[model samples]
Target: MNESWMNEVSARLASLAAANPARDFEKNARGLLSSAFARLDLVTREEFDVQSQVLARAREKLAALEARVAELEATAAGRVK
Candidate 1:
């Protein structure tokens, strides 16, 4: 009976010790990584959307220029013929 009581007391002490902040490795690592990522100059969704729109406009302009070049090339070829 005494041995069983000692085991129960030791288990309770261990449970309390385990609750210390120093033992929270997973939470600490996650917080550290979150802070690291936040330090980076990452864009928000609104900024990404604005950049996407800019890229789309650039693509459209490139397509128009390509079509214009093709038309000019065809006209030049016809003149040569």
Candidate 2:
């Protein structure tokens, strides 16, 4: 929803910029920055946050597994001793 509004505004701004000589430099600079950013293949902030949450969950799982392994190893060692 927000993305749609942003795209709409960007389109309108581009159209207005086309005939505005005063903003020629700003327009060119904006064009260059956008293209450069596009080429970088960056993800949106929302996507990053989602991935961060996933990674955190994964880390929690890993820690639990590690602890279980340690407990199992300790039990086995006690039996041998």
Candidate 3:
């Protein structure tokens, strides 16, 4: 019986706290921060990760092309000699 009473009291306290001004302040602060963050240019982690992968692939291709060009230049030089 005592445990049940304590639980009920705790629940009422929680319900009251939820309606308190501090809760409203917290909600308003969260909204303000969300609005400010939304106004800035930002990419999601998924987008940043995808773009990083794309850049890595592009770098690999460029390196392969450079190596191929160097190999061709060497072959051309050997032929001239």
Candidate 4:
């Protein structure tokens, strides 16, 4: 939110751009932009890790449901025999 902080970031990015002569300028610029945006408080790696674990559990539950559906279908077809 502070203009001075933004200016400082801009200056640092400019320095990075000048120093990295062998890298892609656009990619480096985008990375700098991302870093600046990330300066604001955001989710930490630990929080993201927790969410990833939750998603994995949900996916496992979904797979079990799909397998159960297949088994039910098989049972229903057999009953029609």
Against the true structure, what is each candidate's TM-score? 0.57, 0.64, 0.62, 0.51
Considering lDDT, where higher is better, how would the candidates rank from best to worst? 4, 2, 3, 1
| Per-residue lDDT of candidate 1, residues 5-79 (tens digit) | 557555654655577565564565566556655766688999999999999999999999999999999999999
Better of 1 and 4 by TM-score: 1
| Alpha-carbon RMSD of each model | 14.1, 8.6, 12.1, 10.1
Candidate 2 collision pairs: none
In candidate 1, which residue ranges exceed 4 Å CA deviation? 1-34, 39-41
**Candidate 1 minimal-lDDT segment of 10 residues:** 20-29
Number of the top candidate by TM-score? 2
**Model 2, C-alpha of 48: deviation from truth (Å):** 1.0
- Arranged by TM-score with the best first, the candidates are 2, 3, 1, 4
In model 3, state the lDDT of residue 38: 70
Model 4 Cα lDDT, one tens digit per residue, 1-41: 89998898789778877887746767788887788778886
Backbone clash count, each prediction separately: 0, 0, 0, 0
Give the runs in model 4 whose Cα sits over 4 Å from its true position: 1-35, 38-42
> To one decimal, what is the Cα RMSD in angstroms of model 3 from the true structure?
12.1
Error of 4 at 4 (Å): 19
Candidate 1: Cα lDDT at 64: 100
User: How do the residues 1-81 of candidate 3 rate in per-residue lDDT, one tens digit apiece?
Assistant: 357755755565566557768877567556655665575667899999999999999999999999999999999999999
